[model samples]
Target chain A: MITPGAALSKSAPLLACIGLLCAWQVASLALQTESFPTALEAIRAVPSILGDKESLVNIGASIRRMAIGLSLAVLFAIPLGLLMGRIKGVASFFNPLLMIIYPVPKAALMPIIMLWMGVGDMSKTLVIFLGVSLPIIYHSFQGGKAVEEKMLWSGAAMGLSAPQRMLRIVLPAALPEILTGCRTGLVLALITMVTSEMIARQSGAGNILFNALDMAQYDTVFAMIIIIGAMGILFDAAFEKLRGWLVRWSKPQHDMPLSFS
Target chain B: MKVVSLRSDVQAEPAALPGVAPAMAMIHIDHVSQRFQTSGRQSHLALSDINLTIEDGAFVSILGPSGCGKSTLLYIVGGFVQPSDGAAKVKGKVITGPGPDRGPVFQEFALFPWKNVLGNVMYGLRQQGVKKTDAEAKSRKLLEMVGLKGYENFYPKELSGGMKQRVAIARTLAYNPAVLLMDEPFGALDAHTRTRLQNDLLTIWERDRKTVLFVTHSVEEAVFLSDKVVVMTRSPGSIKVVVDIDLPRPRKRAELLLDPRYQKYVVDIEKLIDDTGEDEIHA
Candidate 1:
């Protein structure tokens, strides 16, 4: 069903990316320096990076950390958001705390977290959790609060109990907003993952990038950058697909244009 | 039509006809007044000294202009909003909160977006502890009654404005409530759809005989549907007049339009609504 125009639109971003790579190649040729790794050199380094068991281990470790931290964040955020959203008094009490803490760089807490939890994986995971949890929680709170009062009244008039109303009406109404929050949280989780690895841990994609820098392996660093970019794009696409599936009942069933990461 | 004759000798004194038994009032609004306190330190009185009694199986319409507290009165009757003074009662019991006995349909067609047509209709029955099979069967029947039998799986977004409103009505009726409170339910629909729905509603009301308290700004709608239209005035809203429509039973839309009586009722209602500077009544 892909028309010529649709095909062209799909390939447009890829074409632009190739053009950027060509420019990089041209610049690398002009420089003709060993320190400046050419596009070909970075492409050749990809297999070696993939072949290295240590690199695979690092990727695995990073994925595991993300999974654990994000899962914890999801668990904590949903209920807290629901609580804060449904109860006005609770929302008012916590609003000031959330506003104050949300903007503060979660990474700044790294040193204190490290001091308390030691230089363990727990500290790194905690940092990532703290960084990712707030956005999800805040978004859920906003989403939950955004449910129309009329909808709630309709449910109540139908003789829905408190729990049934929350589950059947409130939750579905808030799904779109909560999913948007999760999308934002996913990006933040990745950023936090890299940052935590760079500052605290000796494993993950961040560690590989850091080590490449230290060894002056510019081609390997460029290769890792490409891998990271691909990973971010892949995660975003996956989450978007998940969101579409979860909210298919709410949205129109039409193919949407894909966005480059 | 098969008319079953009642045995008048069964009782010492026949109270009334079988259909017009001395039916108890299902919903009673007793001197209910509501006020809103704004942030500007001024209190706005929405409804002032409103008292009305809706008998069981009666179709009453509260006709007024926008912001005339017709909707406020409907909400108070439905127990969604508390009255500042006095109260509303259902079956001699004061309404403190929303319950399945009184179903309300909002003007905005508040169907849950996530739920399809069938799901929305089944919502109330499910909450009432109806078994899944029974609920589905009843919901399907209700949907068919609302002319949405084939659109059970269609989401709210996919439905036309009129279809969505139908789904809302079906959802409310699924609970088998004693009374239905509608707040400008067709106001958002187009003229054609609104008229079609009005006809559909009259048909359903005739079949079900459920009490309905409909609030609307359209005098035509009030005249066409309601047995009695309680016209209210502007700000500090109170019932200005209650015009009884004695049009013949089993009414049809075309017939009502052709009838001069309907036009006269509309004209009188318009005059009453237009007369705004009358002395206010304080309870």
Candidate 2:
């Protein structure tokens, strides 16, 4: 049943990864810069980074914090966003504040947050939480707002109470949009995790990248970049798979696929 | 044209079927009016002092032109929207909000997009605390009744316009509502599909004469499907006339299309609607 287009599209992500590496290989070879290593050297260095116990544990800790931050953000934002969408007063109440906060780079707040709560995992996690919350909330609001009134009426006619209608109808109806929000929030969580770590100079994948740069270990630096990129790709692809399954009934909302492989 | 009239003025109030005791009014929309707040402080009058009594087990169509508040009146009866001035009562009790007593089938179909045909049909039954196994069995039967037996797992987005409406009808019927409020349920379908659904609806209706309050702009649809057609005028919409459809049951489209009585009713209702169009222009 697989169409030719789908088959080609299936391999597209793998093809993209190889193409990027090949391009990087050519560019580094052409430049012949001591600081910039070839793609093969970086790929070779990847085993060393993964084999080191400390680096592995550091990466693990970073991921753990990310999971906590993202989970907390999702818990806080979805209900608030749904309320904002359904009630005009709630939307107006929060709109101005969200607007003021929206444009401020959340990673930039690491320093300020550190001043208040120090540079523990707490401050870094808070930054990730802030980075991830906005998109999910915005999307959930749009999703909840877009729910058809007639659908709620149908639920009501079936003897569903108001809260029952909101829970059973609005939540499921808004799920596709909410998941789209979570997808964006996922990538943002990674970027925020790395950026906040780089800013705070804490122990994580970002710290490894910074430390490699300090000692001029260009291979380690590029290898860490590849590891981070791989994590981003892997997380996004996995999330996309889960999202598709959860909202199988929904029409394809976006054109871009996150590369299944 | 009614501010308040004897219930019979709207239609035969008692609706005494021959050789049967007369049934009580299924719905009493007493002087209901609706005003929508537009931009600025301006308010637009939608329904104007609407008063009508729909008899029990009667198939009544609220036929009108676009923007005539025909659908709004149906919504009022379903208790989705409260009237700005008056109230709508069903079975001698005021309709404060939507309940299982009155189920609505909207033109949009309003099926839960997330639920498959089976889940959509079973929603009401599940909500009513029906056991899982019993609800599943009943939903399958209803799906088969709606000609969607094999499409139990198919989502609403996967179905065509007519099929979706069929599923919607089955979903509302799942809870066994005493009154069915259909707001132009067939308006979105093609001529062929609409015709087929009309016949199918009537066949279903014949089984257990649920009091139906249907709304449609098509005179043909209204006349073909209802026991009475309540013609309405727009822009502060109100009833213009009530035409009793005395056509016999088990109406065959092929034969009814050629029947003089059926053709005459369609033509007369079309004229009535046209007159309202003229009145709208004059106003």
Candidate 3:
């Protein structure tokens, strides 16, 4: 829960970031390891990574794919999830198949998917899509199932047809929960993106980290790690902000992030 | 001056009752029986042969204990639930499903949490294909009538329980439904808010006098607001008695609270309910 001081709550994240870096700087200096660069050294190398046009393009492509994958999953999953939640027959039909697929690592499907779809963006995007879809579907399902019966009845009385009720009533009513799923899915999307790129040795931020490590460019390695870490933090923060606004109507049940990560 | 009586027969005319009524009734529920499959093939009867005729521009309340299926009866009329046996008709036609002709205000308020008060009120009008400007104008008027004028931009969650119910009533009224099916609309509020809303409801109802089917457990509330009170019992819920209020119109709560006739009606209805063995069971 946020305290009474609005300023303190707003600046809490920035303060935490600085505090983490100060700790990292102190620990690296004390350990005195060659491979483990100090926080400042990695910070200095960050410019070179961003300044390089190829690196920027690679990271940009990674983001574009991530955005597309997340959007597609959200579009597909929410409706399916709501249907599953509301209808017993639909739920039963899909439950067994989902159960079988849920346990398998979505990123691990990269190698097999690459074999089938070739080493294109399709395989990578598909993996990310798979990674995020489950959480969104699960959350939307729960949200739809928990909608008040009387709300639908009110909608019915207002001359809303079955489909209209699902859209106007169920969709908005389940939005808070659905947004929670999307937030979790966003975190999963980033994770799956990096992990899949690492496995496939693709041209992404993940590939840059490994390539730098192989060449013994410790600063670049740490710098790449910092960039990816920053991306994750920035993306998560931005998403959390949007989620908060979208679900401002909801009684903020959990102040802490119950992320899939 | 008691025109209505408690007849000995529990079941009303079933044969030819569904269709023969060329009656001027606004809403007619004939021989409606609702049975629920309560776990492992055990079917529990919720409502049994509830034949109710609500005339146009009349205020009727179904008074019963919790789980007596009073709300269920309201839902049947609202066309949200299909009765296991029989049909609810609104103005001579069978209620196949919910329509704009019968609007419902639920106990939970059931206001869209996402939408602000204005948006919620405008929903029915928009659904009915009214132009946006016209819907907005009508919704604003309805909001003012419900006594939540400046609070239109606030979401349902931001409002008090009373305010939320007011918004719900406004939302339902915006559609201009001939029959207002209120299923314990004021039951969730405190006594003070309840009385305030009851007074406000009568003021609003007086203007148009829409046929309202209000369901509640409060005897005083039923007696105060209703033209006729249908006292019901649980465990095979059925209408135990239908008491005609016969009170003068435009009823004022302050005067009615002190009136001997009003007190007697409340007492008589309470006794009827107490005799059903539900007071102990539910309370």
User: What is candidate 2's fraction of native contacts?
Assistant: 0.92
- In the predicted model 3, the residue pairs found to clash are none
In candidate 2, what are the lDDT values of residues A1-261, reduced to their tens digit?
A: 999999997888778779999999999999999999999999999999999999999899889889999999999999989989888999999999999999999987888899999877999899999999999999999999999999999999998998898889999999999988999999999999999889888799999999999999999999999999989989998998898899999987656655553
Report the Cα lDDT for residue A258, model 3: 32
When summed lDDT is taken over every stretch of 10 residues in candidate 2 chain B, the lowest stretch is B1-10
Best by TM-score: 2
Model 3 misplaced stretches (Cα beyond 4 Å)? A1-12, A258-261, B1-23, B280-283
User: On a 0 to 100 scale, what is the lDDT of residue A43 in model 3?
Assistant: 95
Best lDDT among the predictions, by candidate number:
2
lDDT of 2 by residue, B72-131 (tens): 999989999888877788887888889999999999999999999999999999999999
Among all windows of ten consecutive residues in candidate 1 chain B, which has the lowest summed lDDT? B2-11
Docking class of 1: medium
Give the interface-residue alpha carbon RMSD of model 1: 1.0
Model 2: colliding residue pairs:
none
Q: After superposition, how far is residue B258 of candidate 1 from its true place, in Å?
A: 1.8
Please give, for residues B98-147, the per-residue lDDT of candidate 3 as tens digits.
88898989889998999999999999999889999999999999889888
True contacts kept of 3: 0.87
Task: Please tell me which model should have the higher TM-score, number 1 or number 2.
Answer: 2
